[model samples]
Target: MAATLFPDNPDFIKRPPFETDELRRCLTNYLDTPFEFDPSGARPLVGNYRWGVYAFFDYDDEPIYVGQTNEQLRTRIRRHLTNQRTDAVAMSVLDPFEVHDIEVWPLPQFQDVDPKKDRTAAMAARLHLDALERRITAQAITNSQFKAILNEKDPPPGELTVEVPPSTRGCIVSDRVREIRGHPDFRIARRALIMSRLAQVISERQVKGGLRRVMLTQAKRLEWLAARRFEATGGARTVPQEGDQDGEE
Candidate 1:
């Protein structure tokens, strides 16, 4: 039997197998609505609109660690806490509230053998992730003092100090920890680290050229000092020093 064609319809010439006017209208509505895309402020645009991995060491679990890949971090972390999945790591860590101080890093792309594609983005992601893991591990090894500044409540008000072991190599500590703590999205952590590193490079260039630059370089150093003080006081607020103006210019 020959099917009747609607010659008057504009879409009849080459109709998709599952085309419908309702579907077209829905797509059109979605397209018309512009989305705000800020990777650091919101969720990642990849992995079903969420980043893929969550890696952390359990503070109370002695030596246990947790590393997971998921399309939704909140959902996965919730399941892990509630023992909803049999394969979930034991919830032997500290209470959920304690670990609520999370640091998320996004890996939009992974390693690939393709030669044509630019590998800079992927390499940057890997470097940031590796650094984060190393930092967390080092903190665990050195005790709670070396943990992320965000994990501390009511961070201090002055210069922060960090002691890096002589064996540590190619490690650059910046005010990224403060930015990540203020940032709501975990995926932006990696991006913030990368930006901090780039800013350092720019600052170095400016210094070498004898050009005056903004105060970001000084601000980063101050932030690091403030973070350390905050951690030492168990997240309590401290009176500002003679030179400190409550983060003011």
Candidate 2:
């Protein structure tokens, strides 16, 4: 997690961090990797029998959510990305339309584990993965300025890892201002993501829409949301407030 990514909560975690050299190394490596998430409009598919961890990154390629499973990497991941039949995405924990990319590490192969059905190996893998997820989530919180992630909840009580310092990892968000100043196109994509999210919310709320009044309440709220997000990173500048226009004769 980057320092400014999530909002902070003091009571979310307990102290005495655990040792997670592996988690630190994995997370840093993962962040540095270039990945294309679910691209096809069709359903998602995965066939790899790997117990592993995965994450959903937003348009700017920042992780918004993370999960681990000892099941087929395809089946579970499909549920998150391709299969909206499940409640996770529908519940808005992750906004499907705005998700920019996805990536997965074959944790089973990396850890030398077999299929998840094996009772003993699966148990060990699950425990390890739970702790692994906790370590990453904790490390992310430690480095975050807001201290909260949009992604996932922290793992329950267990052996905690030592607080990993904020990484100097190169990401799409790296050198944010320079990158934006250099490539202005990214700014448009960011705006689109925000608008897409608001659209989803408005639709979910069952708000009515028409030609002139096409979700105006939501449209206004979307503007506010976009302004705030951009303002946080200095993407927005002071502009004149939009005033109501009157019809002319």
Candidate 3:
């Protein structure tokens, strides 16, 4: 029996199978690239090897995200890291500025192997990259420290996957305790007062709005910081509440 071919339908095409070893080789080569730090905020995502997996790390060298891209990695990552308004780096979740370091697995070799004339190899490579990303994400989650990597959704061809816990949805404990505490601009002296005021504002408004969200975030950050500072300084001072702006003797 001969299969009927639809010429106008784009879905009809040759689907080639990639061997296990061939994929393994591609994955190995891509993964070989080491983690590179670009404090200057400059990335050379200008070449052929611009498609694959990327990871963001914080100042403490913690995993923040695990993602794969079919487009140019440079442009995609630049949007996340360089643009402040990028929705990719949600304030409720991960902040783009916190991305102190980036690591990539750009499979440039795939370009040559696939060439401009062939689409089959590129498609296969994308699938394999997704598989590799899932594998790395799963392994990292097993370790409590890395369980909080902020991947919005699981990659395709999902295999060996773990659910991002409800508690760890926006961020893990480390995000709250370490992110702000360890930042260079942490000024402990006046932060407690700020936290208290923010708490008070939230209490008064009692509405789930943008202003309230900001206040809540800062308050939590300051409260946590104040607690740590108090422990270090060995003296607990009164945290000012709504109207307690003036702390006196």
Candidate 4:
């Protein structure tokens, strides 16, 4: 009997991340091999199984979600099957024949004595999970589609107008800018601030090439801020503005 290519034996089933020719070949190779279970109750003898990435697909094979786990991949998928926190269950119900594909990637092996390496691997798992979630959200692919959907369902009403807060109105523009610039997610916040600032500058009849230069400089700074936020939160959160709670926009 031929041995499986995976770290674990043939009994350990994992779905490939995507359908590709290379992956099909790998699966064919795996299926051709005879089943073998490890007699030892120990870890894989050759490779690490500390991390894995998986994607949940609908009946049409459209990926609905992606995730990562550091524990046994089978156990993680089972939890998803039962858990209500994510859309996994609903998606499964919506398409009863939903297929889940998992791809296990071996992380750097760590001995029992090496806590630092283990911690690093754990952090990597968390980061991978975050990345998987972002990928599955399909933000880049779905944005235009969502907009079109919305357009078809409900046409645009009109331009959105947000009233400036009166309390903050008298506040010095420079001071307001400084406060926004100091935020941890400074870039987007700063850009919002600049937009507000530009409005203020225009209101004060102070538009100039110097102001444009300043805005561009702040735009670069805001770009850095946005990158940092993406690194921290995996994505940007829309800033809540005044009158937003009333469904103004």
Candidate 5:
């Protein structure tokens, strides 16, 4: 009898590539990292943080999104990236594929603050979260070359100010995944697709001005990346036109 050409899985199901599995594992590992100050390792950063602000950074180390959640950080972030259920993901305001690094500032003091049980504490916790988010948002903008991140809406204005707390930052993408997705052309294509979808969303709905701002920022980022790639590849030497004449018109 001839040997089988390919071994069959016990469940008769195809498996994803090793890199794909590795990528997911990397993400989980990053999220599971013990909070920096937790010496006893009692809690993971994302899982234990009941109120927090998180930022997503793209391959170029540019802050692309900022968000605050009273919901468990793990639940909210997983929904955005893995589940693709958040409004930002659904509306294409953010592309999970572009996120390379994640930075989170967890508010552990508010971990037990329950809105229904203790309205005053909950309100104060919310204020702290808002202030932290605003600070992060400002930092993101200041660090950005374009002076803007891809957030569809600006962080809410508040006189309340808070110093940034201890934060945890990690790369969510595995090196294997980076090798496949790190090419500028790949990123440019992905950004263009997301931008197109965002534009479509704006056209279909009576969206706020903030959504349009996000589209503009996306366009700038796309253009900047494309230009870099083009120049790096030795930009078009000459135009192929009839008689080799410059088309001034």
Candidate 6:
């Protein structure tokens, strides 16, 4: 049957098949979420805080990376996810697509401390940030199903440690994005591709042992997801073709 051609409608807006824009909005909304500073709810956390620590979690709610920044958490996290400015992204140690949730600890106390002018105060604040990062990293490792995250290098061990502070956590993936990326098969394929790219990077350069460790962790994660999917599907049933002869060489 012949079909009639319709005139283009310029006034109609169409949504994209891919959810990139939706995901970006979800991330922005998550970052803009107000954190409860106290019982009175008078002070909400802002994104301009200078000293902060953050963590990224995957679709399965597994921690994938942890980092601290003396700069603004908003800037550092946006660079990691929206662009390749962060070393972790450049090295393929962290894939922004895999990040489904974020948790951040903002230390507003050091917002006014400038490293150039007050070196001592800045250094002290950095130590506290580092300590907080290390503690969070430990918790992530303990909570992870594989007992490891994708960070190429763990936060350096230190004698100093800080108490956990009030933090805000939120999902960054939109429902539309989840409809596609949240599928098990899609996730497995994406993880495998990232692992392959990371391996190729390692092979092409004189990389450190920490990078190698990341590769191993990726392998484990891939294997675990694959196995889980297989189990959930109860494996595929084998069938014989009617035209095929049994035991034919």
Candidate 6 residue lDDT tens string, 217-239: 99999999998898787655433
Task: Output the better candidate (3/5) by lDDT.
Answer: 5
Over 1-249, each residue of candidate 1 has an lDDT whose tens digit, in order, gives 123455666555565323233233332332233223432455332213222334333222222233433244445544543333622222112222123223333333432322235466544544444444455444543553323221211212233333321110111112333243333233234324533544555556534221112123223433554565467665645556677656732
Across 125-243, the per-residue lDDT of candidate 5 in tens digits comes to: 98888899999999999999999998888777789999898889999897778988898888888889988999999999999998999999999999999999988876776336577
lDDT computed for candidate 5: 0.85
Total clashing residue pairs per candidate? Answer: 7, 16, 0, 2, 0, 0
Task: Residues 1-249, candidate 4: write the lDDT tens digits.
Answer: 334565566456465323233334432332233212223344452112334444443212233344555664445544554333433333222111123222232232222223345676565445544454344334322632221110001111333322211110011113233343335654365355544555455467655454454344344444655666667764535546577676532
Q: Model 3 clash pairs? A: none
Predicted model with the maximum lDDT: 5
Cα-based lDDT for every prediction: 0.34, 0.48, 0.49, 0.37, 0.85, 0.84
User: Which prediction has more favorable lDDT, 1 or 3?
Assistant: 3
Of the two candidates 3 and 6, the one with more favorable TM-score, higher being better, is 6
Evaluated against the true structure, the overall lDDT of model 1 is 0.34
Ranking by lDDT: 5, 6, 3, 2, 4, 1
Q: What lDDT tens digits, residue by residue, belong to model 3 across residues 1-249?
A: 123556555455453323323323333333333323222344333222455666766555656577766666655655565443453343333454444455665554453544355678876666666676776566545542524455545557645343321110111123334444454345444344444554555567554554454454445544555566667655545445677668564
TM-score of model number 2: 0.47
Superposed model 5: Cα runs more than 4 Å off = 1-23, 38-44, 238-249
What is the TM-score of candidate 6?
Answer: 0.86
Worst 10-residue lDDT window, candidate 4: 164-173
Quote the lDDT for 40 in model 6: 48
lDDT of 2: 0.48
Which candidate has the top score in TM-score? 5
Scored against the true structure, residue 187 in model 3 reaches a CA lDDT of 46
